[model samples]
Target: MSKASDLKRITELRRELKRHDELYYRDAQPEIEDREYDRLKAELAELEAVHPELSLIDSPTVRVGDDRVEGFASYQHHLPMQSLDNTYSQDEFFAFVARVEKGLEVDGARFTVEPKIDGVAVSLTYENGAFVRAVTRGNGIEGDDVTENARLIKAIPKRLKGDSIPEIIEIRGEIYMRNEEFERVNALRSEAGLELFKNPRNLAAGTIKMLDRVEVGKRQLDIVLYGLGYCQPSVVSSQSEYHRRLGDWGLPVVEAFWEATGPEEAWQAIEKLDTLRNGFEYPTDGAVIKLDSFDQQDVLGATSKAPRWAIAFKFAAEQAETKLNAITIQVGRTGVLTPVAELEPVQLAGTTVSRATLHNREEMARKDVRAGDFVVIEKAGEIIPAVVRVLTEKRPADSEAFVFPETCPSCGTEVTQLEGEVAVRCVNIECPDQVRGRLEHFASRQCMDIEGLGVAVVEQLVSRGSVSNISDIYRLDYEQVVSLDKFAEKSARNLLAAIEASKRVELWRLLHGLGIPQVGAAAAKDLAKAFGGVRELGEASLEKLVELDGIGEKTASGIVAYFQDERNRAIIDALFEAGMNPKAPERPKEGEAVLAGKTFVITGTLPTMKRDEAKALIESKGGKVSGSVSKKTDFLVAGEAAGSKLTKAESLGVKVIDEATLLEMSQ
Candidate 1:
């Protein structure tokens, strides 16, 4: 093909691919088969390879498909995305309506009720009918720049479809991954031996901040614009008109929107939404009620952080009464002791919940939770299963007040609760519970990433006394591992290989693997970046550590106390002597294109590369991968069977890309 013709063909191909992407990712309707989609992608890749000049950054063939981002830059919303005040009872709802009416100086004011999507809020800016930027509602003023990622979302139009496009438009909406899509993504991650995300919303939030644009292109994220931020050549005079016009601009508005004339009608609408929330593909936390008139909205104005014109009526958390059969203490990787309430198996929301976490001694005391007491359990954010309240009226007469355990349940060692902390912890480094917890943390996906060292293996090693500490994990023999139940020669070899591979882990991973209190993966990275290696971190004074951005006095004290422990010091020495070389801190060089500030999320199946391969490539370039898509995701890497992520990418208008193009760009 001639150079000009080739360029024309490439543009045509990209346009066609973008259309297909809109249908599949944004609209949740795919007219083409997976093979057909792949064929089109392959053709685009071939053309782009031949005429690299025609390959644009926003090209469908060039984005990362279905990879997660590392972190998000906080965006302060120009108009704060303030949460609305809510009421669970009819009286409060009526009172709120009366208050709104009184404040507006109107005898009767209509209210528009929309589903409160249980997702992250984001703002999208379009300039001259072309998509320009996307940002998360950080503190409600400034947000991370996620323009490239947002463009990948098929649901969000790259260019206005109609002539009514505003010169400058800032659209506000929720970015959510559907329940089924979240499950599918997590399942795929599990199959790939990666950590599963907790829920759809978190996954959505986590996916949007990725730096690798190619990875963002893959996840098929979506968005639904609900409100207008700042607009030039304004299209509407009222909030209701804005909602009506949003559909014309090819933006997805709330499914059920109603304008109620009074409190009764608003309450009725809220009730209807509550009942219908379960039917929608995405989860809704509650209903958002806003003043229908723009003039009236202006009259009511806003608070320092929230708008007086809008209010979010949150739904009461789903609660179920279950008998507490037993109480058990579990030790976490960081040696913090947690109380667990084993209950009679009860179905909650959609899943069977048999246990609920009792967050700490303080939470238990606050709730007056006791053994044999009938308790009400609820899922916090419909994600974590937890106990909310205790029913004193249903308490058995013989039941006694539950006391926090004074000793480690596994090792019979004394446990202590530190001052200013709610968690009572087992301080013994060699305690069997502590050892198992530490080993599990060491082998976790975020740490050393040993593939085969699952909870079963860790349990076996602890029970058999084959491993007494984190360092002893490196000393485990293949013969001993194979001799354990459910072990085979091949499995043992693979486990050993994974363990051996873990020895060369970076200093950040090593620090996280240490299972230090108050030190999370992010904090571990910060510490590594500051101290260079574990030895240096161990030797650093509390005052020196507290000077770091995220590390405070509490965290500093925790680190110092951990290093001072003789047993911990010995374990560190042993790990150092075991041929492990902690990586030195890498300083960001001047003008380095090290994915300076970006996040990514990967979804579905890539055609040519394994997920890990793509992740390694992104990380090598100084970018971070996350498990879910969110307003924060800079890119969504979408592939075959790309489910809700595509929809979320579309709804949020996150950038979506394929595999071959990602490889070419990485070079």
Candidate 2:
């Protein structure tokens, strides 16, 4: 982007984020999901990072939380609240312990492991063995004084029970809503004809932020003190001692904790914590491992972001069995139709599981999942729920195989699956399901990003026939939209303004929004760079596309085939006709080809750049990124555990390089 355009986008992002913060923090009402909000914040941070001079002082990245809500008086914290670095793999968790040991210059290190509760962090202050006040962790430096709200929690003691309590001390921990309490609250809301809470964490957060103390009390929120933020006279020598003091003082703590002597033992403790996770009264996403000794923690110190002595070991999602009631086909942003399993609601990983992604028909057939069959389901990474396998013993003898649909379920158009691909796509762009999904995708943070065009709004457009195709978005009549439910003068104008603003989108975003088969965010960027415009791409032969870095033969074929249809080309023309002229791609510099003939594979989490960023960097430097490790792979950019890919590369005799080495070589 040009300097002016970049500045404009940053300004827009700031405005949107501030509005969301108000809804989330003050009103206890969130407009977008957490993942969506994270995406926007990430984009804003990236833009600021790229253009340092353009960064605003009040940018969300530089700060922790938004300003305190009007009703809550702000309280100052003695110590800045810190967040723990997260790891999904056991190898990574062990690596973290190794780092701590290396930093402390010790051979064998002891650590404390406990459940990392999924809840809002709060600070409690005690004076003269009496509970003085409690505050939400607003921005680390200070917090919102939610004393009245915190007082409602029955678990929090008004006075200390033991003489071991210090005169002046502050304890930090989680204020989580118990799973039963969460259900009760939701049931009450349902009886009251109110919207049900999305998740336990959000419900807990919303409950704390509520101005009405009575409402907060009704939820029966609970608190568990974990660590000391500050103390008048140094209280404990280690984390284990601190927990002992908490238990002695009659303060609520975690169910259990393990003391480990080494990395292997620490991992075993983490595994033990995982076993205790699903059985807990409250939700837990991972295990928190902390250094036992305060002196060792002090020696290890902390980064600007997190403490070096601790790390979070996240468990792979929990699995549970449920009946596959039915299989539903969903048309994605791209015309690809995906099979989703309708399940008999069963509790798993802190939330009720109703549906699971079958991924594609191929996966469905591989698992031999059918309606009326009992299946094991797991949340892959505790986010997307997926069907793991079918129970052969429980399957009815009369149960038949699931027939993969050859036609679009919504519009009855014949779906086609291309050679060398699993995705079965609806060729008709005019399919209502495709149109709605595409519109939602186009307005997504990664695409054109028209704010206010969410799933609900898109549903209204599709159902009312106000918009039937992508180009119809630009032609939305103001009067027609305002006639739809929930739309008033202000919202109608705002949505129209957003739609108008999306016309000036980047070429890569436009390409991604178009949803070409086998083309994702990265492939879209590659195609955009190789071709000046959609017309140029539409005319490009397969040979020209295959020559580009990261553009595999399969992706090249997809692009060529996507444009082969007149309906697809017409949509491109219609977009231009509607004034949404996307910017052309900026070509790479002439002489910056340091990694000309290299093929790289990245695994695990990198120390600095993300995998996508690394891939982009390598591609721009005239190198290529392969999905898997093979003899053809010239370099494997290994990070941390590096996982099975690194092992495969090593066995295949493929050269491996760290991020540092790769960066040095590129330079």
Candidate 3:
């Protein structure tokens, strides 16, 4: 191509890549897949190399994309946090190794290969061997301060362990969500009628930048530190040595690593990592190969964007082409209609893939998925099956787009899409599918702890018209239950007894079981602690709800809306009449409640009482229990082997108390 054409293409590519960078980094949304983005960047780099004069200094190829945004203080790094150059092809990877060898003037230089964790990059700063702050990798040079949220991750030690700790250091790593945690959080969001987070990476990116520490804590983010940024003493001399030092310091590091002689061995290691990544708790999208010797790395130097010593080889997502036989709509507990693509069964990721989530109506239109069209499907985040794209070229001549129904399939209710929302929901409270899901959730162990209320039993109860709502569970007749399909006299009696016992459970359980939007188990506990009883909580204003630690404006409004609904009010009233009185925590008289309005963190094994017992004692006296120690912590109850939390409390000057002292204070 001529210089003029190259310039035109480069201009367009720069503009496009910049938009994608904004979507991916600052906004936590990406329109294209990682490989596609890489291809675009790679093309621009080639074009720019051909015509260096056409390349501007601020081009995407020469600089790291900025992730900085509002609501966070910018923290300038002591050393720049650079990104790694990525390649999808093995030949390009070998080329990178060849370049490294030529630059260092050496053959078969040792290398370190480890899984490239798919997560948000952050730098953790330690001062005098104590964790001081956490900062995001915002434009490499400067980042957002997220110390408060980072403290909530239990895996991150407040103080470095082992000997020879650096006086001051910036520990670099990726903050990620485990697959189990991701599914759990998505379940809660689905229950709350909120749009589900698409993947763990996006969720983690958004979560770390959240303004509310309380909300951040509830989701449970974790970290894996492998990169070294700025060290005071610069103890480690190699990548392998740094990893060893990280492990000794009690920092979470990559589960597996491979030392290689050169690119051939590095590729083998990458292949091995790919095979084993499915069993890992965290998401590993690819493998990073870095030159082992720190001296060699320094000598080779780096570009303005990435290091010369390292490269990331991203693995292509496993995909299979399947015929989209039909599209089905599923009504969730919150009445949100999710469109699912029913595919002709094809094997993918060790499972027979018959269905994939189209997510919602908007996604279907964006992808233009049609019923008769062949579609490419892949496991999203190695968990959910999703339709990637439609095979439009091979489409049936008479194929048509999958039109989302205006009414709920489960019920004849007309669906409504709320303003500024993509979800088309069936607002019918009595939708059969929704009722079944709600009943199942209310009876789950996390909520009311009702036993023998499995899906089959709930299905039987609903189908028989013996139970319609959560309130119906309380009013079930023993005779009616015994006569059900699988219920015997003994099982029926146990279930009835369990139902009876649930009435006297802690108030938080009842609150959670009620299925208020945005009110998960954690939020329910906060609400129970603040309001004491369901009746009191119902009468509290939105302002009062928002005043609670974890309860944000959206959650507060959800609570208010739940209470304002006359139907929900009637359910509560009915529950009260059915001998249902959830036991609120005993409130002490003003002078006697010495621990009132204070937060305490319990650590180590106590002399007599267990941690839960100590927590219960504190909560009973109007105090709160926190999982971690912070400046806001009024007291740290210490005992035998009170590890990092005790050290943190001492550092922050938070008062340390023994179990005996706690007992005395309560008395």
Candidate 4:
């Protein structure tokens, strides 16, 4: 290629890399695989090396990707949170070790090897044995302060325990979601018709930065502290000692740790971690190898972007080649048609994998996946199984393109793919598969908290034609339930009693269980609190609904559309008729609307009440509490150490009030 062409290609690569950096760091929504991203970065680095004059100081290769976001206060790190230089090749890893050892003028430097968890890196600060702040690793220098959300994570302790606590310490670690928690959260999302999160890492990253602490608390996030950032009166002299210190403080630490004398032993440790990581609760993508001695690490030092004392060896995603027997479409609770690949049993990532997700019709068409083709399936993030690629050369001679069904396989009703959407849906609400899905969702713990109404029982009820719709559950006869397979008299009574008890559940649960599109538990709670009951909410106008907090135009429209549907209205009427009187939230008195028709944004630590307490108090008196302050905000409830939101509010000319003033106004 000519110099001009190389320059043009370099420009294109920089643009692409910048875009991907935003997606991966700020948005937590990466389109390309990690290896592909690494390859692109490496290519850019190589091209820049060849043409030294073409290199830019602010290039993705030189600078760390910033994860800082608006709405949260920025926290300057005590010590810069630098990233580790990583490689997929063993030779490159060994070269890294050689560089480290050469810098220290030693033959074999002692090192520590631990699982490089695929998670959001964070720095937690503790002052005098008490946890004070948590921040993301944003651009090495500063990051968004996420103390409020971090406080809710049970794994993060509030105070230090055991002996030899430092006056001030900053613990560095990764915040991640467990595989089972991810699955549970996805199941809820799938049931509620919300888009499923791609992986545990993305979900955890997104969850921690969420403005709503209540919503963040719902998703379980775990943390593992292994790195020491900054400690006053430094006591630990080695990496192993640091781990012990972290553990002594009642902090969650890495599950696996290995000591290695050299690069070869470190590689062996990494291989062992690869074999054992699948058994870990959280996802581990690679092994982080660091110099064990603090003195050694200090002597080696770091570059502008990464540390010279440490490097990460990323393991390739575990994959297995399997025969694709067929492609099957499964109808979800919301009637979305999902195509699942049926594969011949093959061992992958320590599990027997016979199926993988094809994602959508667009993905299938893009990949040209066909039935009877030999396909490579990989466990993405070591949690979700997905078809990585099709081995076209090994395809059968008569292989056929898997055709998406034009009609719902369950009800034979014609399926329709909505414009601007990839999901093909069976809109028939009464479709057997959809019914079973809805029944299960309505009975889920997050919904009605119904006991003795698991998947098997729901399947039996649906298959026996005993339950047709959500309301049919309320009408199930005791004798009919008892007659089902394996159901004794005691089991029948329990099931019936549970169904009967569900009638008195919270209004939010009923609203969530209704299978409303785009409305999850949080939205349901907002709606329930604003409108008091389902009947009143159903009768609300779009203008009125949009005026409420958390109710956007699209959600208001969905609510209006739901109520306009005569079938849904009939279901509501039947529910009421069948003795299902859900408990409505307490509404404010007519004279207590002092803060009525106003938007308030709360910031910083309050003198008496917590943020959620303040939010609830505000909501009770006919006022709305928003997550972020803006020009539209009527008041900024400023407290101690009010951060960026307060400054933004002042600039925007929004009124600032103390918590005491807020209390006075509300009264």
RMSD of each: 18.0, 14.2, 14.1, 9.9
Model 3 C-alpha lDDT per residue in residues 1-667, reported as the tens digit of each score: 8888888788678767866776678767676667778789889989989887555322442246778765587776877899998888889999999999999899998999999998999999998889999999986766888899999999999999898888899999999998779889888755432346667888899889887787887998999999988888878899999999999999999999999998889889999999998898888888999999999999998876689999999887789998999999999889999989999999986568899889889989999988888999986344568898998999989877677898899988999999967999999999999999899888865578676776778888888888888999999988988997656888789889989999998898899899999776657878888898999999999888866655668789989999999999999999999999898866766777678879898876679975657877897787888655655679999987676567778877889999999999998
Which of 1 and 3 is ahead in lDDT? 3
- Model 4, 468-546: lDDT tens per residue? 9889998889899888776788878988898899999889999989988767665787788788789898999999988
lDDT tens readout by residue for model 1, 533-619: 888899999999976645657679989999999888998899878777866656545544355345667766778765657766766
- Pull out the clashing pairs in model 3: none
* Residue-pair clashes per candidate: 92, 0, 0, 0
lDDT for 512 in candidate 1 is 80
Worst 10 residues of 2 by lDDT: 56-65
Each candidate structure's TM-score, on Cα atoms with residue i matched to residue i, is 0.67, 0.54, 0.56, 0.67
What global local distance difference test value does model 1 have?
Answer: 0.73
Candidate 3: residue 520 lDDT (0-100): 64
Task: Judge candidate 1 at residue 199 and give its lDDT.
Answer: 65
**Higher lDDT: candidate 1 or 4?**
4
